[model samples]
Target: MVEALLEARNVVKQYGTVRALQGTDFSAYAGTVTALIGDNGAGKSTLVKCLSGVAMPDGGEIFLDGQRILLDSPTSAQRLGIETVYQDLALAYDLDAAANLYLGRELRRPGLLGMLGVLDKAAMRNGGAGALANLGVRLPAADAPVGSLSGGQRQSIAVARAVAWASRVIFMDEPTAALGVVQRERVLEVIRRVRDSGVAVVLISHNMPEVLAVADRIEVLRLGRRVARFAAGDVDVEDLVGAMTGALEASALGANDVEANDVEAGAQTGGEGNTNGGNGR
Candidate 1:
């Protein structure tokens, strides 16, 4: 496999009374949707916070293109070309799509007006509109307040904004949650579009079918640890549910254990069990 675009190794995070992450390891590859799934309280949220620089991990190494780096704040992550769309959407309710897109990184007029805090609305609007159109997201209008848009449209804005500025990775937290079936499908299509554009995507979702349908690979977290990583096409919903419920430890494999077992099984079975070899189940 190619080196991961973003990686977290042996990451640990803890609150005073709760240990949120326990030596967790995660990675995102360019042009793939890596779905992170786990039961509630399984530390998915904690891991996301750490990865997006919303919170600092107590200990661990985070790497970008194999180089260790620090992500102490959301701004830090953004500067590194990592953007996160939180579950809350994180937009100003009254702001238009373009305004929300350029919330903190707004364009200003040249020279004196720029120094006087004059924003270049036309430039920002054009940029935001272009981004949305490029991503194939349909919205009523780019200048309409986000609060006035439908659930899917609002989600699309959030995703489009992330895609516009994100050059390396995008973290999406339950992007289709609480939406209608159509809206969910639209969001899924947008996710595929993003991945196809060659940006690494880390999706945190509880929807099993969505994960199975959209993810290239799936990582399951159990009790603050990554218990299994599976190639999406190699596993079924039953397998995923089993891993989540602790009913199928046989299929749960770490990076090294997977290869080791495949080799052992191949030797024992005269290479017949090797059919699924290299599938990374």
Candidate 2:
């Protein structure tokens, strides 16, 4: 609430027939990791696409540090200092770590006669490696082809790419998805480093344990709508699942003020009826 670095409100997205996202509100402050979690089909992907500028929302407004702005394209988002690291990473497997790191923003060195026909390979190597380290990601070697690296290593490279160029908020989609235990931890460590470096991070993940471990706040979406939000320490996994499943409202978590209907439901359920009959049913 201390003036978010990035704030999105009432964002809506739709396909020709499918309304993938409904009105939604989300924000991430500087130096914090805001995790967005939900069950499958909870509009997580659609919301992420809108935030990343892959798909512009048909409704709602977005603000950067209290200033309303327009993001019509991916380049527009980048121009606003919002960088995104997708699950696939969009990296070229054929390239090495340094090459992959500088995929779009390649380093160039001036050649003789002012004809710069050379890629600054040395500079990229050193700078890329240092950036990776800054994000707490240690690659085996900067010269190693990205295709040869393990899933975790590749993820680390992808996250490092975002942090290295992002001057504001970084959106990470499943940063540790499919990674082995050690590799997952490594990716999480890098995410934490990014947060500590003062960049706001929006992490999209299905891994609740990982979310619980790294998130400073959690947002839950259900039926294509944002149903709840809570400070990390103020809520538990169960509360998040309740919001995602439509059993809880925003107040069920840490909301200070409860609406009339929300209060009535709370009275009947004792604020715990969201559970599934105490069984998996």
Candidate 3:
């Protein structure tokens, strides 16, 4: 097996009395997608916070590329080539797609002023266009205002940025939640490209079909604790839902199942009446 690009062992976190995570063991391979599934408040967001360095874990360790390290802050995770695209997609609506693509990490020409210098707009445009093509995503234009683009295009920009910048792991939080049919497919296609390029992907999604379609493995987070792990081929969507909902036995499926349960369904996902199911995207 390939070495894990990111690994969390015995990880625990708390927000006063809430206790968001309880000693979770999670890992992702360099060229595969791992879906983190749960009903809600299953510590999915908290786990993402810890993994992305948004918050520090109260205990346990995180290892990247086999080296145990401390993620005291998001900057640390970024410095180590870990990046995340949140549900908002984090784009500047007023700006064009290319502009949002390089937000904060803008390309600049060699001039008297460093960051104060003018941006290399032509280069950025070309580079951003290339990145979209490289990921097999189709959009109207690279210069289109992000606000003017379709839901998929905006999501594509966020995903394209993560792919363009990351070297190891990319965490996507509900990437397809607010997109249309064609748009959602485009986003999923981009995800496959990310994995194909050999980057490990951690997807926090409520859409089980999306998870089953592309994930090589599924990890269930219930009430902030990882309750079960499933190989993509070994478990069906019903089983996954059962696992996520805390209605299945640890040994529901033989051999391939690793059982864990210190937490139950503390949260409900965006599917059903929840309505934010990015799975459609």
Highest TM-score: which candidate? 1
lDDT of 1 by residue, 193-264 (tens): 889989999999999999999999888777777777778888888888877766876434333232323212
Q: Tell how far residue 107 is off in model 1, in angstroms.
A: 0.7
Q: Arrange candidates by TM-score, highest first: which order?
A: 1, 3, 2
Task: Rank all candidate structures by their lDDT, best first, as comma-separated numbers.
Answer: 1, 3, 2
Provide the global lDDT of candidate 1 against the true structure: 0.81
CA displacement after TM-score superposition, residue 150 of candidate 2 (Å): 1.5
List the global CA lDDT of all models. 0.81, 0.77, 0.79
Candidate 1 worst ten-residue window by lDDT: 272-281
C-alpha TM-scores of all predictions: 0.87, 0.85, 0.85
**Considering TM-score, which of the candidate structures 1 and 2 is the better prediction for this target?**
1
For model 3, name the residue pairs that clash.
39-267, 39-268, 40-267, 40-268, 42-224, 176-278, 177-278, 184-281
Better candidate number, 1 or 3, judged by TM-score: 1
Error of 3 at 252 (Å): 2.7
**1 against 3, candidate with superior lDDT:** 1
